[model samples]
Target: MSGRSVKKGKRPQNSGNVLAVETKTTTTAQNNVKFCLNHMQSGFSVEDLSKEARAEFAMALFKRRGMTWTEIQQAPKHGLGSEKMPASSIRAAIPRVFGDVENFLVLRYSGLLPMAGVRVGDVYHIVWLEPQFGDLYDHG
Candidate 1:
């Protein structure tokens, strides 16, 4: 058989594998971009929240639910300036922003405490607290 005849019968080998690998890489990158965008939109973070700011946040929790001072104190402390708060308390107090009370109640009943507020490693908290409640006295 002639070389031209042999070449005409066989398909190009690299084209199919190259297309498959490119498709996979493109999909992975797209997924990564989507993940980053979602994280940015969530607006949850823990950095730059001062002790006083956290206290103010806790105070807001108290006001929303009319929680007594003692109840406020009893609120779970993830530590000073920490962003973690009991999800039950948050759900009960600020269900509009968090979620339905029923869900939180179920979590509590199951002994699976959910946490809210800014997590220590979160970046959104840093931006939110500074401009809004940087001064404790500003909280109503």
Candidate 2:
């Protein structure tokens, strides 16, 4: 793997298009996302999810070290699998950065809602998750 490779979503292994995004903000520990307490009341404790699923979340968020915001996947807001809110509203909570809209992106995992974030220079900060989904965050 050489610590850097873009596994395109053509194979069955990547059916969900599990993406590894990055940010300049260094995490003290690997695979630990600062969940938004405001939008969420409570969800599965990272410890509670299956080892495989937890690993998936971690791998999906491994940080696309050098990938640009445009290179990574961005959830769409109109037609087919559209989110409840418009893209602008989803990005509204996040303040301006570097005067570029291409810097921010939203990604949906196997959970109920999608996560909103921004890519500032070399940093991609996951600001929050959409607050519309039910409390429980599970694929099934």
Candidate 3:
């Protein structure tokens, strides 16, 4: 049996100088930009990138860690300047699981190298790391 004594729907009272901690829910925190690589395509893996390219990729992520998705999409040259890539514009076939994703966001990680991902909530799930421009899709 549990030793704690607390009434139903009632929080236990703090006896001494301890303060109760509550979690704050904020929209800004919820909308902050985050990146994930779980969905990255096999051939476009980061492991294949050259040493210089890899360093640039890490630096890019570090530079934008504090920005929100909106800020990343809105700023001028420094921003991600993401473009929409519809399925029709994509050269490679996406897995059936992501069939309903409709479109993907393509951004440059280094010079014109396209990094494609899907946004779910605040997380941008990386799907591809196209090292060469126009290799994955038409940029025209």
lDDT of 1 by residue, 1-140 (tens): 65564435666467555423444333321221100112211222223344654565455433423333233334453321122333443312342433432222110100122123232111111112222321211211
Deviation from truth (RMSD, Å), model 2: 14.9
Tens-digit per-residue lDDT, 16-107, candidate 3: 64423333574543366778988777777688678888888887778778887778778654246677788777777686667788898876
Query: What residue pairs clash in candidate 2, if any at all?
Result: 21-63, 21-64, 22-63, 22-64, 23-124, 24-123
Highest lDDT among the candidates is held by which one? 3
User: 1 or 3: which has the higher lDDT?
Assistant: 3
lDDT values of the candidates? Answer: 0.28, 0.41, 0.75
Better of 2 and 3 by lDDT: 3
Q: Per model, how many backbone clashes are there?
A: 4, 6, 0
**Residue-level lDDT for 84 in candidate 1:** 31
All candidates' TM-scores? 0.19, 0.34, 0.74
Tens-digit lDDT string for candidate 2 (1-140): 57888877775443454435444575433333333323321233344445665665455555434333444433243211223223344323344442345433445543545554543444445555444444322323
* Pairs of residues at least 3 apart in sequence or in different chains that clash in candidate 3: none
